[model samples]
Target: MVFTPPQNYNEIKSLLENLEAYINSPEFHEIDSLIKMPIIHYQFESIHPFYDGNGRTGRIINMLYLVQQKLLDIPVLYLSSYIIKNKNDYYRLLQEVRTKDAWEEWIIWMLKGVEITALETIKVVNKIKILMDDYKKEIRSEFSFYSHDLINILFKHPYTKIDFLQKELGVHRNTASSYLNALAKHGLLNKVKIGKSNYYINQKLFNTLTKR
Candidate 1:
């Protein structure tokens, strides 16, 4: 979605340009903040900047804006997952914003998602931290230094390919493979082939990420 854009659209370039101008302004979000997050969110969605992936991109922007405003310390708020569940209402409200300029209702919906998503993310972060602590305190030291680093990196990216590790950790590709392989040996990871790429997932991290 991020890479594949929609067909030619007049609003796409204008939206990106507006977003660039907004994010770049030193005092930009001050007024946005005063109106509260919902208006800002409605505005983002209403702007509908990209030719494709506008919904996903707008959700990403929402999360980033929360972090930028210090409303969140992490980007774990999966607001889109909720919006996906209410896709009909999401689209309906967006349409209302477009047709009727119904700012209040749109903003309310966004703020509600913020509150709900914030609570949900807190629960997730707490569980992940607990899992992280357990792993840090109890994992055997015999797994090697690479294994330790790989486990930690998995907390950031639950499943990763060798390229991500090589670039992020400044390790050789084989070294990254060795690290992931060690985790697989320890029964901490399951190796999976995705398309042409092989990815390793720390089982513990996946459990936290995919928990009910």
Candidate 2:
């Protein structure tokens, strides 16, 4: 379905202003955040204010609104993945809202996305934490240079360079290179050279992050 938004600049601006006011208004504040969040997302997407990136901006607004309502400590819960997985339903339900005034189905679809995304995010976070702890224990047992900072830097970058380690750990360049080489020898990291620069890959962490 083709959804034509406001063609006039002033009309778009005025509508967006009203949207912002509604977000902070007492009427909106009274609604439960779970219910209001979907409404806010629908309204923002319907606005289609910018020439481009309206969908991306709308998703960002969803995270920010959750933060504002104290539903999330950080913007880690993303519904984009869920929406992408249900792409056809996502678009169909959105269009139904306009064509048939099917608000209930649209709201239910958004809430389901929220629930699935949140659960997946929690699982990923827990997995990362467990992997980090395992790495810390193994590295400490195997290497004299083991530090929590070293573990953090490895997981933080997944693919790291000698320069990154040198800067972050305030160590000499050669010292950083030696540390990385040692990890490679111990099978803790995979070392690769590309165009005169060597990089260390935390394969386990990389796998964990990229796993479906």
Candidate 3:
């Protein structure tokens, strides 16, 4: 495989220097991190320091920077989906900066992307909360001896094994297997065997998380 970057050695070196200066400079913290994220993103993509995955790495940094700056409580926002949906404009705005020095439009585009992605993230989170509540109610009503901790563990991970449930509930392997099998019978989980171990998959939570 061949890999290419937009910048040469000297250009990349200069870009790195600028990046360090920006990180330590007052302007980075003087403005809100959310407001500064777009400029930082543009610089990173323009530098294109990596042979591959520059965009992916820069996007990850965007989310990390938000957390680092305490702008977000969690890095759950799905910024890439918005960018993927508007793939053309995303690149075009970046190019506008390189060609015409259009900082305003590029920044605005990124800000809008953040806003839209944030709202989408909120909606997904609320949906998951509703699902979790429904699952709790159904589990409580369906099972006379249901463990709330078991429910927490299930939602924490969409996939669970006999060993996992056994450890979480401090029950024997047979008991754990029985619980998973019961859920499968109730249509709340699907049982699948991988090698020697069996896993119970939470279909509804998986669907909600992977919806978009």
TM-score of 2: 0.89
In TM-score terms, candidate 1 sits at 0.70
lDDT of 1 by residue, 1-212 (tens): 12223244666666657666766577665666424555556656656555568678777777777777786787667688678878888878877876788877877787777778778878878888998776665455555463566557777777778898898888999988887787677776789988988888777777777773
Error of 1 at 193 (Å): 5.3
Q: Which candidate is the best by TM-score?
A: 2
> What is the per-residue lDDT of model 2 for residues 117-151, given as tens digits with 9 covering 90 to 100?
88888888899899889888998998899998898
Q: Model 3: residues >4 Å from true position, as ranges?
A: 1-14
lDDT against the true structure, each candidate: 0.71, 0.89, 0.84
Give the candidates in order of TM-score, highest first.
2, 3, 1
Ranking by lDDT: 2, 3, 1
Please give the lDDT score at residue 194 for candidate 1: 84
lDDT of 2 at 104: 95
Q: lDDT score of model 1?
A: 0.71
